[model samples]
Each structure stands twice: as C-alpha cells, then as structure tokens.
Target: MRTFYLLSLLLFALASCQQPAQYISNEGYIYGTIYHVTYESPQGKDLQPEIEAVMMELNQSMSTFDSTSTISKVNKNEPTELDELFITIFKQAQKISELTDGAFDITVAPMVNVWGFGFKNKEQVTPQLIDSLKQLVGYQKVHLENGQLMKDHPNTMLDASAIAKGFACDMVADYLYSQGCKNLMAEIGGEVVAKGKNAKGNYWSIGISKPDDNEFFTQQKLKAIVELQDRALATSGNYRNFYVEDGIKYAHTIDPKTGYPVQHSLLSTTVLADNCMTADAYATAFMVSGLEKSIAIAEADPEIDVYFIYSDPNGNYQTYVSPGFKKLLKKEYE
Candidate 1:
C-alpha cells in the first residue's frame, strides 16, 4: 500500500500572515521520501536537538533496519527486556489483531518474504509454496510473557511495517508536544499525525490520493481531503506493491486466515482516528475485509471513519464513506 507524505504549505502561508518569526523544517524517511515534521514555535531552534535525540532513540528502539531492534529480538526468539515503547506498540498491535479477527497480523513477515516483498530469495512462488508459507502465518503463534516476548512457532516472523511507522509518528508527535511544540505535523511513510493548529490557524489539510492505473495522476485524483487537529490519518492501497502473473494481480497485503494475497476490488481505504497506530492498522484490515464488511466495521465503531474506493464487478469504480467519514470530505468530493 502507498502512504503519502504531505507538507502543510497552507499552514506556512497562514503563519506568514500572523508574523515574520515562524520557521518550519521537516525530517524523516518513508519510501525513499523524507517524511517531515513541520515545527512552528517561537523558540524553534532550542528544541531541535531534543527532537533529534528522541528521533535517534525511536530509530534504535523500533527500526527494522536495525538488526538489534526489540522487534528483531522477539522474532528471533531471543530473550530481551521490553522497553515501554515496545510494550505499548506491541499491545496496540495485539489488540488490533484480535479486534480484526487476525486480519491485521504483525506476524505476516514470512508471507511477505515468500511473496518477494522482503529480503527473500526473490522468486515466483508456487501454490504449494504459498500453502506451506501459510502454515507459518497466525497472530496466535506470537506471545507476550512476563515482561518478555516469545515466538511460539518456528519461522513466525514479525513485520510491523503496517503500523509501526504510524506508531512511531504518534510517539514523536507526543514528544514534540512535550517539548512545547503547539503546532506540529508528523508524517512517516505517508501516515500522518497532526497536533495543534496549522500555520494558517486552521486544521491541517491532507489529500487522499486516488487509485489510478496511471501513477502520474495518483495524487491529482484527490479522492478526499481532510483537515485535522490532534488526529492521525492512514491510507492503504494495492497500487503500491503488487506483482502480475498470468493476468492476475497479487498485492503485497496477505490475509493471515488464508495465507494468500487478498483479491478485493477495493483500490484504497483511508482511516482517521485519534492515533496513527489505530488508523494504520485499521486501514489495512478494512482493505482486506473488502467494501461491505469495512463499512459494517466502521459503522460499528464510532471512533473510526473510513473512505473506500472499489471496482464493481461490472468494471465501474465506486466510492463509499461511513457516516463518520462524510464530515471530513471536501463538500464537492462528498
């Protein structure tokens, strides 16, 4: 799925109207793009070092790129003490996995590797191979013991790529706020968490991309736009990672229950919630659940608002929004 990084230029424009003293700079990396956090405070420079320090700690604590990360230890079945940050994120992931009926599994790493999305052999997988790989997929195989983690089964790896980035953004945002940043925007791999007002003194406006066959117009399609203060938004779509074989498209997102890539017609789903982790995980879960069930789940939860784009069996494209989501859409788009 493609996640977008957006800089609030409108906030900058508005800040200029109020004073000549405010400055903003963004920093972070997601999908080869530098995901940034725009900081606007009267004393911005003093906080830069502190922000950098927190970012460093976060990278060390959670980064999959680091072979020594807490998640890596858990996946390797090595004994390790759980940091508070790791515990918080792991709990949230586990809760979502259960709530979604294993639809949002963190232990999908093996499947991702077998499908050639990770550092695997990078070969086309056969049905027999997929079946074997599916045997290793399940949330139940992962366990959290007394202050430690244990992988109950062999080859059951953890891939927190789905929600960890967003969780990281939330943690960073919380840190920024603690550092006296009243107006800030944190984005990691297109998942965003906005706090306080933008430079314009209005909520941050984020553009949700359209699922288009042409990559050039993905951003231009602008399925929906949202303005947020103290909220996080995450979008999941099949357009970003997929392979075609025999005229069939196989997306990177795998269903843990079936151990195969989902074959839903929905192109994208965006979720807005109080935290990026929830939004991030739910976006993936809803995408796998397809249109009807996604809507049903969103309706059942007042905290979640979802926007979905699907292709009808007749080849017509349609968009569906939950009641909670309609308020966030631009009037024209709604």
Candidate 2:
C-alpha cells in the first residue's frame, strides 16, 4: 500500500467568484501531515475547537506514531479492547482486503516497518528478512472478536496508515454536518470529502499533484482539477518515498502478496467514492493491482470512479480516466 502526504492542492473558492455564503477555514497538523478544513455556516459559527477535539480523539485511537495510541497497544500484543473507532476501520479494512484479494491489507505492518515506511525505521531488509516478515502479513491471520482483536499468529500486527486518514476526513465531515453546516470540505492528510458547495455556490475544486519525484511535496503542479460535490476523493502515488539502489528504483508501495516494493509504470491513482475511507482504500488497492486490473475493477464497480497517471513506453506521463471520473474533471494539464 502507498501512503502519500501533502499531495492535494485544492482551490477552496475563487476570490472573484460570486459568494452568497461565507466559508471559514481552519488548518493544523495531524497524522504526520497538515489538514485544512473549510465550511460554510452562519457568521458567528466557528468550529475549529470542535474539529481539533475530533482530530485528537482520532489520533489517540489510530496513530501508530503515538506509542500510547490504541493501535500501538494492540500492535504490541497488549491486552486491549477494540473501540468503536478501531472496530469500524478494522472491519472496513477487512472488506477492502477481501474485495481486492489481499492487495490492500492492514496486516502488512511488518513489511512497512522493514521497508522504512511505517512508524519504525528501516532494518536489514534482506530476502530472508522479507520472507520472515511475509509469514505475519496476511489479513486473514487477524480478526476482531467481541470487541477484542484475535490473532491466528502471535506476531500478526496491524497498520491502518493506508486508510486512517480518509476515515479521519469522514469523521471531521460528520462533525461539521452535525453542527448544522450544510456546506463543508473536510480533509485530513490529502484525502478529502466535499459536501454541499463552496462559498461560490459551486462544487468544490480540488487539484491532484502531477506525480513529480523531484521532491516529496514542494514541486507541486496540477495534473488535473476535479469538481467534487457530496463526494470523497483520495490519491495514492509512489513518486515520493522511493530510492534508487544498485541502478534500480524502489518505490514505497509494497505489494502485500509479493512482499516487495511494486515496480510498475503506474505513477498514481485517484479515486472518488461516497466516503473518503472507501476512496482511500481503493486508491491503494488500485496502485497494488497495477493499471489494467485497476481499470477493470473500477469499471465493474459503479460506486468507484478512477483516474490514473502512468508512464508510457517513451517515459512520458500519460493518463487514463474512467468515464464516471471524466465527468468530474474540471481541467487537465496542458
């Protein structure tokens, strides 16, 4: 699975555009990345504090970087009961894993840590080490039973990095909606959920990065801009967090089945769905499944709209946008 950060550069509302509404924006750091939230409500309404409280609760429940987080305790094999938040994400992960035939798995934590992509630093990632870690890397090896996690193998661990941010987006959006805000855009990390419309009375506009490997985030140029309304969007790419070793490039997206970094021309995958969590998980799954399989899966599922950026035979960037997704695109790079 690929965990990307700082990839979305969204245009909240065009300044010159008409506005019958006022949009309040709030931003801070969470989940190792920045989050920006904007919503339209009455003049005296400010939900920054409420948003922060929601984020704090989610971080405590799911962040692997926090040693005292609920997920960290579960990963350490400590006796811990699964909270509602944890169970919801766990079940959703299991569903996606099964739907993707294990391509998107939560039990790939050991491989992620070994590859220097998870909470821990990289270790000696030899072939033998990868094989040893593979033994503990199956979603089927873990399950939640009566609000407690059960493991077929004692070493089976979990990592929700792939899907947690999207869930966070959903949670924050729900909070805003509960407060009677009909128009809102909730984003955590790079995953986003746009509800109602922007201040301009138009669907929110979000830009997807051009999959440039020069920098993790700095060299951002838009590949496309999408109009989102009552929908969630997420992009997964391996352009960042990769290295060149022995004349070969190693990307961060690990194929859970192969126990190695994926080597493919598919540069990035962006998915749109009813909720951020589903979009987030499908985006990662599409990256693992490669181009053709991803398109096939997207075509079969009406709920999923996909857009892919890939490198062609001559090493030029190319694109394949699904029909449903093409309708959502506002502009493409010239």
Candidate 3:
C-alpha cells in the first residue's frame, strides 16, 4: 500500500508539470504589417481584449501619423500634460536623442514630411527646402516641463515612429506579466520583446532576416538566430521604404543633422537590448552612424550589442559585428 501511494504521488507531480496554455494577441495593421503578442494562457478571454486595449491606447498616444495623437497635440500646444504612456516614450526619446547627439531626433518629422516619407502630401523637396527643415530639427528646442511636454518652436512636429513601436511591445509584455503570464512574446512591426519560454519549454527563437535584393522576402540567408529568454531585438534596414530617383536611392531614415538620407556604406543595423525601445532607437542610431562609428559606440556601451552590414565603395556587401553580439549568436550558425 505504501509503494502504491508513493507511485500515485509521483504521477500527480508529473501531471502538474504539464505545459501552460497559450494565447496570442494581435492588433494594429499599419505600415504594411500586423503587431502581435503571444502569451502562455488558459487565461480569460479578456486577456487578448486587454492587450488590444493597451495597443490601441499606444497608437492613440504616440502616433505622429495621426493628427489626433498626443504627440500632435503637444506639437500644436505650448504645454500639455501627456498621458503616462506618452511621457514614458518621450523620456526615452530624449535619452536616445542625447546619446546619438541629435542623429536620431524625434523632431525630424518636418524633414520626414519634406522628403515625402510621412503622412504629409508627397512632394519633391529641393535642397533649399531641406536646409530650412534642418533649422527646426533640434531636440534642444523641445523641453519637458514638470511632466508637461512643450516645444519652444511652433510648426515643429514630433514623430515617435523610431521608438514608439518598441515601446508598445514593452508595454504589452508588462501587461502580460501582470496578467500572470509566465511567458510572452510581443512584436510590434519588426521590433520584438520576449519573456519566459514558449510552450515547448524552450526559449523563443528569433530570426534576423538578411537584407537581399528582393524586397518580398528576407534573404534565405539568416543573419542571426537568437534564442530570446527575456530580451528585445530591433533591426533597421534601408531595403524597405526607399525610393530611387535619378540613380540615387533614398531611404526613409533621415539624418536629423543633415536633413537628408544617410548616404553611408552601412546597409542595415540590428540591436539587442533589455527593452524594445532601446533596441529600436539604438538600431536607428547605429544605422545613421554607419559602420566604424557604430562599432565604437557599441564597444563603449556594454549594455548594447550591434550587428552591421555595409556596402564597400565598390558596392560589395560586408558585415561587421560588435563583441557583445558574438555572445548571442547561436553556435550552429556562428
């Protein structure tokens, strides 16, 4: 009887170890893709609904693409007490702006519009127009006053596209954790953040797509496959959202200081950090900085690792990776 009782207890323990349920939340079909969140579940149906609510709030809060967004309001007003979500994103934007030395300014919206990359009606902007736009593209002119956002100059719009999606991903991850989710992965566009493991009890495997000539699919070649346990990853590439005029290819990522597209040899940059916002912002900063300077930046900051792909003057593709990034590469592909 004692042996049978012990066996029963062992079986119970095994049964209790069964995998948790899984749920997926997806929202916002903008910029040509869908943002999604996946979490361990058996959670109430309200789980997805709540996650969607957070995403909706973020879209309403941070989208400069929308005329009704909080950023739009702040740009049009002298002082506005932004919602906590907008405030959080604004703080991160300021930090990144300082770090990149204005290479990644949120106030580059005017340039973005002038270059026809934004919601503004597309038009061919001349060098004179670009020069005028640069005058308004400085983070120093924008200030956060007692949690109230204020822009010193009028007609100076703020575009949080560089960091807002990643912020949304982080917010979704935090919300999932609050709902007792032990594991979750949230991806807003290409910006991704993962917590805990998948249903298989293994880390989530994320693939970095190689920038190839074909825009339809990421090159079959894998740049890096990371096993994310509790981290975020973001990639910025010129392959998407680019237009070639008179043999010069112009990408959407504009240099805030130059008021023009970055004409560097760097093709793409991928960053891995503790949060999606940092990863997203750093990726764009590194992309703008090009290869050598970006490597120096990554080496100086141990908290972030970067991978850069560049084209030589001869148009040959070459890749350079930071020391910290080497640690994250799965051995089989490394």
Candidate 4:
C-alpha cells in the first residue's frame, strides 16, 4: 500500500512538470502608437498593466508633446531636474551622434520644429531660417551637469523621438525578462526586440512594409520579412511621413549639418542590433547620411546589420542587403 501511494505521487509530479507553455499577449496604445507584447508564459499570466506602467514612465520623462513631461520643461528651458531616463537616452544620443558624425543629433529639435514636424507649429521655411537654426543644432552644444542638461544656446532643444519608441520596446522587454519570460517579442510602432523561440518554437518574424505614402499611413504591402532571434530591429523611412509644399517635398528627417530636410533616394533603412535603441538611432542616422556614406559606416560596424531600400533613377525600387542581414531573410526578397 505504501509503495502504491509513493508511485501515484511520482506520476502526478511528472505530469505537472510536463505542462505546455502558452503564449500570452498584451496590446494597447501608448506613445501615440500601438504597442504589442507577447511572451511565452507557463503560468498563463497577462502582464499588460506592468508593461504599460513602463511605457508611461518613459513618456513622463521624455514626451515633448506633454506639457508636464520632463522633456517639455527642458525644451522650454524651465528649471527642471533631468530624470534617469533622460540622462541615459541623452548620453546615448550623444554617443550615436558622434559615431555617425553628427547625423543623429537630438539638438536638431529647433530645426525640426521650424520644419513643422515637431511640437511647434510649422512656419514658412527659407534658407535664412535654415542657416539660423543651424546654430542650435549640433550635439556638441549640449552637456549634462549634475543631472541637468546645459545647452550652449538657450534655444537649443533636444528631441529623442528617433530613439524613444525603440528604447520603450527595450524597456518592456527588460520588464518581461525580469518576470521570467525567456521567449518573447516586444514592439512599439515598428521598432522591435525579439528573443528566444516564439510560441510555435520558431524565431520571431518581423515585416518591412513597402515604401508607400498615403493619408492613413497603413501597412499596404510587405517589402520583405525577417526572422529574428535574440536581436532587435528598427526601421526608419520617409515614405509614409512627409508633406509636399510648393511642388517640393519635405520629410520629417532633418539633417543637423545642413538644418534642412534630407533629400536622398534612400527610402528605408532597417538595422538589426543587440538592442532596439541602438538599431533605432542607427536607422535614423542612415536616413540622414544617405546611401554611400551610410553603406561605408554600416560596413565598418560589425555589430550592426542593414537592409536598405532605395529608388533607382528610373523610379524602380532597389534593395541593398548586408551580408549579416542577408542571413536573416526567410527567403530572398524579390
């Protein structure tokens, strides 16, 4: 009788250990964009609230649109103490700016605002305006002292929208990881961090949309798809976000060097890095650097992989995929 009782307990323990893993997804709107996070949970728990809490914290720190946000106060030159999020991202931005030769400057906020893509109202842009804004657009003009951001010019502003969404994705991934999620994917807007195998025991998949412009800005066609494992991806493109005025087009991506919107054939740049923040910054830098310069820089960095989509002189789409990035493709993108 004792032996039979012991055998029953052992069998029950084995059954409990063999429980199948389930995928739990939590999705909502934050940062003015849709965020989706899915994780493999053996406990079948949804961590939407916790995930949202992290996003809210980030917004409170760096959302320029929110008057009460920390960044808003800084942009206004108000006497406000910088938060850790601001310090970290600000330093990261500086590093990327230096690495990209000032192509990824957060101090381009003044230029961005004048171009009508920032928090301020759009104005009639002119060469004189661009030249004036150039004075306040270099990353070297700002420094952090005692948790305070000191600018060379009082009007010099900072904008981290290029990297904030990607960092938010990283933050959510970090939270999920702390909660014991090994296999998961986190995406904000289009920036993503994917690690481990997915619910179906395969690496996560990310899609790159076709470079098309429209009012709604929906995902119309897939230019390509990539399988990602233990890595992050970020894409920057002007195709979906631009305005035409006076028979000329102006994209949101501003060149800090020239204080003008970039006029480049490089339609989209997708970068894969160890973290979403790095990928995001590099992707935007590539957009500002244009094709040849971006190619040279991308080749020099072994930690980054890139896939560039540009337009040929004849208006046909052309693609350039790096060797490392080529390995991640599910199949050749025709």
Candidate 5:
C-alpha cells in the first residue's frame, strides 16, 4: 500500500455534492490489500466479477504467498515456462533495474527476508552474512534466456511485491478502458490510474500522506492533495516500515547494491508517469537513490513528474516538487 491516500469524492469544485448516479463504484480487498474502482457508465454495468477475475489471475501468476503460483514455482527452481504476466513483470523489472543502476531490484527479496522485511524473523545481520547473501542477489544474476528464466544461483529468487500493485492498477484500468468505459479511476493499494473526470466531472483527487511512522495507517493526514487525470500516481516510502535499534535506525527498503537498509533523509517519493508500473518502480528507485540522485533522475526523464518529501538537516519536513508535478498539486505544505 502507499503512504498516499485517494481523496474520497472530494473534487475541488466550488460545489461539492454527492452524485452516486453518475459513477458506479466498487470497493473490496484483493492481493492482500484494498482496491477501489469507479467509472461513469450510463448503463450502470456491474463489473465486479470481471475486476475480481483480473485480481485472481494476477495473484496466480505473481503472489509469493500462493505455493502453487508461477513465481513461487520459479523460486523453487522448478522447470516452468513463465506465464505472460510473469514474463511481462520480469522484463519490466529488468528495465527499471538498469535505468536506476540496480536501485530497484526484484532479486533483493532474499536479503529483505533476512532483514525481517519479508516472511522471516529479523536476526542480527553481520557484514559477513551480507557478503554471503549478496551472491544470491542482483538483477544481472537473473535473466530470460531463450524465453526461460535463468538464475545465476539456484537460490536467487524474484519478488515483484514492489511493482505488483501498480501493475494491478494498470491491468484493472486498462481492462476498463478496453470495455469502452470512460471517466474512470482504478486504484489498488494506493497505486492509482485515473482517467477523464469523476462523478462530478472533475479531475480525480488524490492525497499524499504525511511521512509519519504510522505503520498500520491507523490515522491519515494529508500532506498535499493532487488533481490527477490521464496519468498514474504511485508513492514509495520507508518511514512506516522501519525500526530503531540501539539508536540506529533500520528501514524495510534494503539497498540491493549494499545488502543493507538505506540510511537517508529522503522520506518518500510520489511519481507520476504514463503508466502505474513505471511510476511504482521509479518511486522505489528514488527512495533507494536518496535526494540528489532522485532529483537527477526526475530531471532526466521528461515523462516523469515527481513530488519528493524529505527531512531537512534540522529534521523539518520539506518538499521538492518537480516541474511537472508542481502543476498537479492542488494544495501544498511548508
């Protein structure tokens, strides 16, 4: 899930009123998180079954929790022809890894697990242990050779959790578009794709959350509100999934290159891109690269607009809004 929040039917129009008739909405849980879909259809089509089916297919191909899932089978080193979803995700992951100089790696799952960010309990990780684990980690260590997934080490695994929700959002949103639905928004776990207008015929409103250590998201507060249309928004942060040990802080986002959690003041990154998958990957890349490199990456990519929240030297919250994202901000904070 994202530290960002999808603003609930609150368009910034002068007149704020309810219009359930124009927008058909569905809310439920899938892929271990919440999903919300809204679209404008005069015929009032109930596509919950279709949307749920999409989620089911994605889970079968990518969910690590499913023992029989395609990814799980691959992790087990079984001879399997990767499904279309699996191939697509794997290819996309490789592209992002190269783009970010391996900042966003799917092969870092084993390291993450050892850090207690995955299914395993946290242990006292030493430099020796890290060096040993680094052997089983690296995007270059895995590849699609002649249409088969090949790994450098038998234990080298892949975990697409970082980009799954964003891809799910894109799949759901693209499915709706193919069905001729207009003026719609699809959001899975805060990675979102909003198109056209909403029920009140205004841009979709999304809220970026304050980067506080509210791990369970018990309380929600808006750091900024964005007006979005025809674009995807994804946010990545480590503030929520972190701990302090003996005055040393450890975050869940393990650096793939170093086999350790990143130590940086960069709190969160919200990226807008032509698609949710790209936005999701770069958001994590920005977090891993920290402030200066993140700014550099955003500046180089014309298709990307980013909103970065970081702490100043004084530990006060400050914002860095890329030129493209600045225009989308309906509200801002100091």
Candidate 6:
C-alpha cells in the first residue's frame, strides 16, 4: 500500500508539470485595414466580441467615413459634444502640431480631400486652390470649450485618420491587460502595441515593410525586423497612396503648411514610443520634416527611436537609424 501511494503521487506531479497553453490569435477588419491580435493566457476565453466592441465604439467616436460618428458631426459644423476619445486625440494632436511646427495637423482635411485622399472627391488642384485651402489649415484655429469643439472657420474640419489606428491599438492592448493577460501583441493596420512576451516566450517580433509602391501588398518585403516588447511602433510612407499626372507624382501625404503633397526624398519613417498614438503622429511629422530635421528632433528626444529609409542622390535606397533604434533591430536588410 505504501509503494502504490508513492507511485500515484509521482504520476500526479508529472501531470502538473505539463506545458502551458498555446497562444490564441484573433484577426479581423477594422478602420479600413486589417487588425491582428495574439495573446497567451493560462485561462482560455474567446475575447473577440469584447475586442470588436472596443473597435466599434472607437469608430463611432472618430470615423470620418461614418456620418453618425462624433468627428463627422464636428466636421459638418454641427453642435456635437466631443467624446472622450475625440477629445483625447484632439489634445494630443494639438500638442504634436505645436511640437512639429504644423508638420502634423488634424485640420488639414480640406487639403487632403482636395488631393483625392479623403472623403470628398478630388478637385482641380492648383496653386490658387492650395492657397485658399491653406487659409483653413491651422491648428490654432480650433479649440475645445467645455467638451465642445470650436472652429474659427466653418470649413476647418478635423480628421483623426493619422492617429486613430494607433490609438485603437493602444486601447485593445489596454483591454487585454485589464483582462489579466500578461503576454500579448495588438496591431491595427501597421501600428502595433506589443506587451510582455510572444508565443515563443520571447520579445514580440515586428517587421517594417519595405517602401515600395508597386509591391505594397503583393510582394510585402520587409526592410527590417525588430523585437518590440512593451513598446508601440508606427510607420509612415508616401509611396503607397499616390497618383502621377503630367509626369509628376502626387502622393497622399500632404504638407499641412504647404497645402501640397511633400516633394522629398524621405520615403518612409518608423517610430517607436511608449504609446502607438504618439508614434503614429510623429511618423507622419517626420515624413514632413524630412530626414535631417527628423533626425535632429529624434536625437533631442531621448524617449523617441526612429528608423528612416530614403532615396539617396543616386536613386538608391539608404537608411538612417537613430542610436536607440539600432539597438532594437534583430535583422537589417541590405
């Protein structure tokens, strides 16, 4: 009887030492892009409905395409009380606009729409049209008073497309954390917020897509791969959304100050920050600031890490990595 009892205890200990549960991956469409989330937890639960609830709520608050969205009402100059998400994004956008000296502006929707990149149809773009739209494109002209957004000009609309996706990624990650998840990766579009460890029991791996307009979704080549744990990553590039007319290439990334798509060699910029929202806004700002100015700004801010890929004078690709960004790279493309 003693030998049998000892054998039973040994077998129970072996069963208790079994491997942990595998990671669960959930993916779907949101905000006009694909979103992917993966998490590992000891307790199994299907959190898709909860995650989609968060996404739909955010969309109702910020989606310009949705006529019933809070942002749409504000855009139409309707007297709408801004939601917490809209207010938070607006406040952050104002700060980024000030920091980048108008390189990042939510009030550039008129220019964006005129360029055929927004909700409105494309118009006959000319110097006069650009100059006229420039009158409506200043962040200082908009303010929030008692939860209401006030605009100096009736047409000075707000568009949060630049930062909304990143904010969504952060929101989803926050929800996962609140649910007792210690390891997870949340990505919306290309913006990502990675926390804890991945399925491999290591830092989450993120890939930076190469700045190629022709093979954006088809080839999908990665320029670099980095381990991002407890970090948010965002990338901005002008190659994908663009049109060519009269031998001139017009990209969707417009300069808020100039009221025209930027004509710079800076192809793409990737930024890493504690939050995806900031990273997303800065990525767009850096694209406007160009490579040299962007490097200067990133160098001054110790918390910001950046990786830049630009076209050199010889038309060949060249890369610039911030001192901190270089440390994150696990693989670098030649």
Model 3 lDDT per residue over 197-253, tens place: 886788888877766667545445666787776889999988666677688876667
Off by over 4 Å in 1: 1-23, 28-33, 46-49, 118-124, 216-220, 331-334
Candidate that beats the other on lDDT, 3 or 4, i.e. the better one:
4
Deviation (Å) of 178 in candidate 5: 1.3
Root-mean-square deviation of Cα positions for candidate 4 versus the true structure, in angstroms: 3.1
lDDT of each: 0.77, 0.87, 0.78, 0.89, 0.87, 0.88
Off by over 4 Å in 5: 1-21, 118-120, 214-218
Model 4 per-residue lDDT tens digits across residues 1-334: 9999999999999988774767998888998889889998766677888899999999999998899999999989999988988888998899889889999998888887786744234568788888888888899999998888898999988889999998999999998889889999999999999989887889999998878665344647888999998999999998777777697666778889997778878999999999999999999999999999999999999999999999889878899999999999986455
Per-residue lDDT value at 204 in model 1: 85
Give a tens-digit lDDT track for model 5, residues 1-334.
2323333323434234432335689999998889999987545677889988998899999999999999999999988888999998889889989988899999998888887744246667888989999999999999898878998999998899989889989998888888777788999888999999997878999999888775355786779999897999999987787778798666768899999888899988999999999899999988999999989878988999999999898888998998888888999754
**Clash pairs for candidate 6:** none
Position 2, candidate 6: lDDT:
100
Q: Candidate 6: deviation at residue 71, Å? A: 0.7
Clash count of each predicted structure = 1, 0, 1, 0, 0, 0
Q: What's the alpha carbon RMSD for model 1?
A: 10.0
True lDDT of residue 270, candidate 4: 98
Q: Global CA lDDT of candidate 6, please?
A: 0.88
**Per-residue lDDT of 1-334 in model 1, one digit per residue for the tens?**
1222234666667776763336476675543456778867655454556556666676666677778988777677777788987888778889888878788998888777776653244467677887887777788877778887776676788877788778877877888778667788888778999988777788788888767667743445766787776789999998666767699776767787776778878888899899999999999998778788778777877888888888888867688877667776664352
Candidate 3 differs from the real structure by a C-alpha RMSD in angstroms, to one decimal, of: 4.9
Question: Model 2 reaches what TM-score against the true structure?
Answer: 0.90
Of 3 and 5, the candidate ranking higher by TM-score: 5
Colliding pairs, model 5? none
Tens digits of per-residue lDDT, candidate 6, 1-334, equal 9999999999999988765665789999998889999987556676889999998999999999999999999999887888899999999999888888889999988888887744134457889998999889999999988879998999898899998889999999999889878899999989999999987789999999888877956978899998896999999988787777687666668899998777778888999999999999999999888989888888877778999999998878899998788998999876
The root-mean-square deviation over C-alpha atoms between each candidate and the true structure, in angstroms, is 10.0, 11.3, 4.9, 3.1, 10.3, 4.1
Per-residue lDDT of 139 in model 5: 97
* Candidate 2: regions farther than 4 A off: 1-21, 118-123, 215-218
